[model samples]
Target: MKKFDVIIVGAGLAGLSCGLQLSSKGKKLLLLEREGVVGGRTSSYNLDGMDVESGFHRYIGYYTHLPRVLRKAGVELSEIFMWEEKIHVRVNDEKPLVLGMAPLFGMIKTIKGLVGNRRYLSLKDKLSLLPFFMNGLKDYVMSPHKLDQHSIKEYAAKYNVTNRAFHHLIVPLSSGVFFLPPERYSAYVFFGLLAPTIPKFYKMRVGAYLGGMTEVMCQPIADQIIKNGGSVRTHSNVESLVIEEGKVKGIRLEDGQVYRAQHTVLAVTLYTAKKLLKPVFENHPWFQPMFQLPLMPAVSFQIEMTKPAVPIDVTTFAPFTCLSSFAEQSRTTFQASKGRLSIILSPPEKFLDLDPQETLQFIIKDARKIGLDLESNILDYRQVNHEYDFHSLEPGFQALRPTQRTPVEGLILAGDYTRQPYFATMEGATLSGLKAASLIK
Candidate 1:
């Protein structure tokens, strides 16, 4: 039996962030991961000398804590990410609508860029959205929790937002970002995330990593933890929590290896955390709400094209299509991935059971509707599916999210699913980790 001051299970963003913070504070730590690599959802793998990501990931400008944590790990945001000022939304049989941000040109230019798409948004359509926007900002100041009972679609309807605007704007945002349809996603979570960026809307830019996430981001954090005299063990599958007298002692591995610690942080996925805790803390009040939290499956495709399909590196969204969002990676981040289309499939329930070839056919059909001839430019493709991808932000789910601190003395939870201002995003995960670290000692 080995002993340490703290033991963190799962080496994802949450675990890595927690480990780095605790290790830096001079606490002897041991970080364990079941997979060979560190980044859980934010990881990348090598395919025939080319790096392929688990899914399409983007960094929103509103992210504050994540960048701070990265800086502590000796990484500057600009060094690894390329920023884009425009967002593209493709409507079937029509040209892609562009939403631009002119930060240097100031707020007037930014507002014009946002509402200037007269081609898709009419005067009435734009006017109808005022109630939602006003309420979103107002709710942010008061409490977004009051709106948690309504879905995005329901909220829009309640505010009398026109269907054209709803289809063009809300549908794409809900499906593209959360992989959930507007009818299913919570309005509070959506607006809560948007409200913070309104003040900095002109400065809001989306960023893409320049290289593999594990190499440029996760590895540096892991190295920093090790450099601080902490141990990071990969391929270590924790079987169960070691509990004695209602307090966490440590964890026991699948191979029957015991590692004890004064405090233990389970920074795994929501599903994994439920599985580990249900045996012991299933009926506990703090944990009971967690059982009601839903899980979402994610499927993403990496399509290598003979030629570039998209001209720019900006993210493109096609509402009502199988695609959530996609980008030309060769132009955006990795030069080796030139002509590669990194696509995330939305409403993932439909594609979960289909084989890769069948899945590609559906995508090809949808691509044609949005003016992309994927069939003619065939090369190679890879599909990555995560069974328990994320925690679903369904209406009423906001109240279900548990806090980082639990009733158990030494047992802590850390993940994007935990209570946080942000949704299941990188910022949320980083914030959860930092909150978990603060609970210790």
Candidate 2:
């Protein structure tokens, strides 16, 4: 068996980031990935001569750590991403309303947008949210745990947030961002993630990548690791950890190959981690929460259009539909996607069993309701589905998140689902990897 200083499993953003940080410290590293490519949830692949991403991901301005790691990998954020200043939201039959991307930085711009769209949120509805906002900021800093017990809907009720605001604003935000309904989503996870962005709002701008994430983001980081003398092996699936005396010795691949190392980091998803670690550490206190973490499926579609469908690159939210959120990627990232649409189907539970054609019909019907008439737009469409995609930010899940420093010696954990200030986001994944790297001796 060959040995190294550290062996990191799963070359997703977390594993890749961990390797980069460790290699920078001159630690001999081995990064293994089950998939042929890296990026994990943020990965992309070529389909029908066009680049299809795993999903539509936004690089929000409030992210501080992800940018730093990207810079270290020699990838400039501005060069790969196209920034957007506003978001378009369409609620029911009401005309679409525009909101500033960074409300705190452009307070006047945000206020003007909101005020101009009086039908979306009346003066009373807007004022009704003041108490919720004030208490959320306070609780986020002082006692975030207290808010985790209640769902966003229940918490909003305590502040007497108007029904209009709840349906118009909160519903879209909860469903669009998390793919979960407001009643099931955790208030603490929602606001806690927002609190960190407050300090960086002035410098923040939401951006969409200019190309496939794997080519522009993941590959560059992997190249940096190799350049620094670290090894990144793709299609190397780990079967299990080599635990001796309650400490991780290294990992055993499915092919019966064993690689030894002083330290091992499991940077895979929550569901995958549980499958790998449960048999050995099921009764262990540190691993108990790992089994309890909730996992959800994600579904998205990429449509090809004959002509430009959406005119702008901004993210559009249309709640209470099969299509919760979408973007015109042709305008932002791919010239090939021009006149095409990338959509995220929220409350994905209902559509999980539907065939691609059936799902596309539902989306077309929903789009027509919102005045988007996509049925007549000549084109092909593709659907992407992940059975166990996201970790739930549902009420009480926040407290169940494990820390990067595990109780087991020489073993570390890293993923967005792990205990981090941010939720299941790019920033959360990147930060978790950095935290795991910091734990290494």
Candidate 3:
């Protein structure tokens, strides 16, 4: 048996970030994964000579931690370029409307509702949020319980802001990023996102890599983790976590080897984490129910065109299907033979029943409606269905997610599902991983 200070399971973005942070502190670590690669969904692949990602993944300039970590790993940020944010929303399938920061008119109405009517912002709820926007808005992100107990939609409804503006604008925005509809998420999580997004922050433009997210972020970070004395073992699945006296001691691989460690980080998705920790929390009824937190799926259609006709090169959000967001990436390379366009679609949970062909048609129709040419410039296509993108953050989910420190000592939890401020995204994963490592001695 091999032993180390920490053994991290699932070297996804979250695990990798935790590994990097812990290893940098001189902690001996062993990172394991069930896949051949490290990136969970953030990694990219070359499909038929075109670089593609699992879904629409990108980095925002305001993600200070991501850029700083990449720089520390010896990566050049200049390699990645920022694209102007090109997001849009449609109300009831009418013309897609372009929007500016905060959807000013919608926000104004929300503010008015909050002030004029008791139905908009309840007396009790007002007490919770008013302080943040009035006397304490600047430092609200630092608060742990701003919306800790209430759902985002509940907050909006309480303020009488659940109109078409809230649904098409706020719902799509939050749901697309978090995989949870606004009506079901915690107000605190929403507040956390709003805290960082000032006008200055939005003006930097939502950014993407010149190539793919893998090249710009994940790959470079993997190089750094290996260099920092941490081992990233892909395709090494942990069948069982060996614990001693309620403390994680090691993990037994499916292939029959036992790698021991002082601490273990379960950085798999929420569903996976539930199974791995089941043995430890089997007797606890609370934990069993906690394991069943609702989840949403993510699907994407990657199209590599034989030729280009339209000059559409921006990410957009469609507010129709409880659908989250759509991102169009232009892969214009010097050696490129044809135009490479990637469309990431986050359909609502109910839409999971549709097959790829149906999804393609649906997206194509929507694309045409949104002023993009989808019929002419087409070659080959690829689709991915991530059934477990995020746990459903519906009302009453705030109290269900696990924490970084679990009932089992040394068996830490790390994933976007675990008490993260955001529901599910690259940033959320990174933050969850970083938080897990902080729990280490």
lDDT of every predicted structure (CA atoms):
0.86, 0.85, 0.67
Q: Where is the poorest 10-residue window by lDDT in model 3?
A: 131-140
Per-residue alpha-carbon lDDT of candidate 2 for residues 193-250, written as tens digits (9 for 90 to 100): 6676677778656788888889889999999999999999999999999999988999
User: After superposing candidate 2, which stretches have Cα over 4 Å from the reference?
Assistant: 47-50, 103-108
Candidate 1 stretches with Cα past 4 Å from truth are 47-50, 101-109, 140-143
Task: Please write out the lDDT profile of model 3 over residues 55-170, one tens digit for every residue.
Answer: 76656656665666677777776676655444455443344555433223245433444453443224554455443343233334454445556666766666555364465556
By lDDT, the best candidate is 1
Ranking by lDDT: 1, 2, 3
Model 1 steric clash pairs:
none
Report the poorest 10 consecutive residues by lDDT, candidate 1: 101-110
